[model samples]
Target: MSQKFPEVQGGGSLIIAWQVKEKNVLVVGGGERGIQVAAGRILHALNADARVTVVCPSSGLNDEVAFRIAEKQVSHIDRNFEPQDLDAADMVLCAVDDPEASTRVWKLCKERRIPANIADVPSECDFYFGSVHRDGPLQVMVSTNGNGPKMASIIRKKIAGTLPDNTGAAIENVGLLRKKLREVAPDLKDGAKRMKWMSRVCESWSLEDLVEMNEADMSQLLDYYKSGEVPSLKAIRDTQ
Candidate 1:
């Protein structure tokens, strides 16, 4: 088991939020079960603005995979995996039922130093797609390294349940407010001041209040930041 999962030597893998935008992702296979895995990876890549190429027999494709190809959302190869497929691939996702084929893909990916995930074969995977909860720009991922996937999912749900439903909107509004604040105080020397002011604002506002914050409220907040003052709740509401 330790040989199968090298990370066991050091607790677990280090989790990170990878940026795959504009990168090429090679997806292989679309068998009955493979279809689900392929479709998921395809959608996730597209969501990250990554270029996707699906390599699978036409008959093996599921409705979702076929629909994506029909809509020109991704390029399709309509054939089995080939060594050349990894030429420009930043990553690979193999979901074929044939263990040999999956292993071959993993070997090629390793040769090229490209990360790969072979469905249902955690031993060959360079990465794991753990349970994730996404809310606008906020994403929380729960990983159990390759063990207890269902447990990871349950924990993810409990974590998500603890957050307010509108938490995403609040975060987005705060991000926008942060941009406006930067514009109002763009001097490099004021970085610490800006951070402190933003921290104060975040701590003082409720989730609902942050969600309802408008351009006027942001402008008033900037005024307070500029004057080195922290606005009271009443002062913030007066702007509305």
Candidate 2:
């Protein structure tokens, strides 16, 4: 099967959210640079139950890789990479310092129809890693499309500083409200009615209000919805 790359818009790279859970990931090289890339992949995979394998000569293995190996978080092959290493890999990271090896890995991955990321070699990479900021269930990623990684990091830091600490909590409360709505207003299952009700609820409750709500407040909100009372748009606007 041929791989379909995402379309570029406005001369910028296309951004996407990929699901890597339970997938096989291959990391070639275990030096300082390679360790950094592998560490990120391992962290992302930890919560998703994905499998990660690192291949690098023992002499090139860094302390970080050694520690992860000792902890049994990822499987490792203490030797140089081989062409067959690309077999069964859903994603591959080529971080070796040798340009020849990196090029070979990239070519093999392309032949096998696997997505590959070659560190510092955007031309040979299928994708580039972006700077990510995660807050509980909320995750924000910033990417410069391999044009400027340092700028992406700076932007990520700026955005992370502006987000409220309770942002994640607010999202969780909204989720709870959604579940209650399904039970309390089953009759409002029609898409329009449901959307309007949800809009009212969202407007009536601010992020701070949602984060500060207790069990009593949640029960009261459910009762209000069950009473089939829709707050007037004027009232919603006034709250805003």
Candidate 3:
């Protein structure tokens, strides 16, 4: 790892989000690292349907996660990871066999907000992804906080192993119900009222009962807000 890659920053603006959604992605490397990374890049996409292009002369996207990638799949460049790699790429991942080459790629990515990940070393990466679990539109992620990746991996496996299969579905329902609550009241106090509705929804409904919860009430609230009407909470929730 390069000394330039610090454990933490003293004073600098570090980015915490990505620019890719309906955007381009590029990965360079064909070995195990490249293949895994290529798969991951496709996995985290907000718009999992966006196009991704991988350029590694020796390797390409693997079949293991090909179905997921195919849904938002990547195209292969069939060439060595070169400076020209970024020309067509929105973000880059350097999984090359060469450390120096990876470092070089890191420099270019750093110059731009274009997210980059260096497989040879975590410290060199602009950002890293943690193992994630998803249910419908809900997601739970486990990040290492750029500390001990091995420990993070161990914890992630523990989480994934222990989590109930219905956990994600429950969370998704909560999110959907929250949207409904907001719709029912136009001038509901911002913080607690919104959060309170979510709390009530959780308390009132079982994970399985979420599907049976009425969306019409929530929809009516949102519709009232659109019509410039702000109803009281009790009126919206109980009296309708």
Clashing pairs in 2: none
How accurate locally is residue 23 in candidate 3, as Cα lDDT from 0 to 100? 72
> TM-score winner among the candidates?
1
Model 2, C-alpha of 100: deviation from truth (Å): 1.1
Among all candidates shown, the one with the greatest lDDT: 1
Model 2 reaches what TM-score against the true structure?
A: 0.80
Residue 131 error, candidate 2, Å:
1.1
RMSD of each: 5.1, 6.4, 7.7
lDDT of each: 0.88, 0.77, 0.63
After superposing candidate 2 on the true structure, give the runs of residues whose Cα lies further than 4 Å from its correct spot.
1-9, 47-49, 180-196, 214-216, 226-240
Tens digits of per-residue lDDT for model 1, 4-23: 86453576897988899999
TM-score (C-alpha) between model 3 and the true structure: 0.68
**Candidate 3 on 89-137: residue-level lDDT in tens?**
6777666667887888888888766678887477787677666666666
Better of 1 and 3 by TM-score: 1
What tens digits encode model 2's per-residue C-alpha lDDT throughout 1-240? 234876545856667777887799888885667667666666665655668888987778777777888899888988999988887799997787778878998888888899999888889988878898887678888998899999999999999999988898888887786777777666644556666767777787677877876555666655556455655434433444
- The regions of model 3 sitting more than 4 angstroms off are 1-19, 46-50, 58-72, 187-192, 211-240
lDDT of 2 at 237: 38
Between candidates 1 and 3, which one is better according to lDDT?
1
